[model samples]
Target: MPVRHRWSAAAFCAFALLALAACGTLNTVSGIFGNQINFTAPQLQRYLNNSFPREFDKLGGLVSATLTNPKLTIPPGDNRLRLDFDVGVRAVGAGEVSRGRFALASSLRYDPATRGLHLQNPEIVSMEVPGSGSLIKGGTRELLNAVLAEYAREEPVYRIDSDLLARLPSGKRIGSTDIENGLVVVHLDR
Candidate 1:
């Protein structure tokens, strides 16, 4: 083989090795410096379960009940309570990444009688970890939990038409009535 060809081959091999080395470092960089590894649903759920209920109990008047209307078309479960929730997640800024907040506003069909809908909130909760990445999987769980806990109960999160509330056998009192002096009970335990 020509000397120039040998040099060229050597240069190509060096570039290939460098490219492989760069690729190999990606997982390690993700491990050490990216938010891709921190989004664990189970872990977040456990944290929320422990942290949120106490906050709820402290914030009086929001009754945690469940849906009992046999004629109503809604998600299954005795804990399907109607409630209003506001969720916010703030990402702590680090390095070149700018910090930001994710917020969600929604009125839920919560059953103050069964408290089933509380489960729905956490299902909507999302978070951004510094290196592990955003916790899109069931981040809503914590977000819902947090929002429900902090919700101001005097006003209905969303207006339930009196007629609709009246349709449920246990309606009006649990549905249209103000949760201000009402109680909010969380049925889903971690």
Candidate 2:
């Protein structure tokens, strides 16, 4: 081989080795950083405000319901999320309609397998249906839970997208979730 070609080949090999070493160092450094993500209440509120209406509108069978003005709050003690919204419900064929405000409190669970935050054990905290009294309130609660269960089965309240998960080092996964000080803190671990 020519001297110039030999020198060029040697330099290319050295550059490749250096590039590989840098990549390895980056991975090592990222692993040591211990990634954790904090999702604030305002962010979650925006997501729910945007998604709840679209999801609720899809349940258009016996009862047609519309959710508007969704308000999210984190209650003290339990790490559950409280969602208050204005609901309008119309029953098909029965000619009965109700418009009122309702609140639902649900416990949050983190599913590592899917990298999503799921709402579980949702309970109707309060419901006001004019003229129908407690009977309609009870029925509304049951209907809401049923509908929410179906929705939750298919979609999580919040999912950590694959792109975000890819940023974490291999083997590092979401560990735990805590709701405090109006924030959802997600821990990541290997």
RMSD of every prediction: 22.0, 10.4
Angstrom error at residue 77, model 2: 4.7
How well is each residue in 56-130 modelled by candidate 1, as lDDT tens digits? 221242322111111111123322322222222332332222122233323234555432222333232223323
What clash count does candidate 1 reach?
44
Ten-residue segment with the worst summed lDDT in candidate 2? 25-34
What lDDT tens digits, residue by residue, belong to model 2 across residues 1-190?
9999999999999999999999866522312245666675666766676676742533457776677788888876657788788887778786546788888888667887656787777777888777776777777776777766765566566776677677776887787776755567677777
Per-model C-alpha lDDT, please? 0.32, 0.71
The C-alpha stretches of model 1 lying farther than 4 A from their native spots are: 1-73, 77-88, 92-144, 152-155, 160-190
How many residue pairs clash (N, CA or C atoms closer than 3 angstroms) in each of the candidate models, in the order given? 44, 0
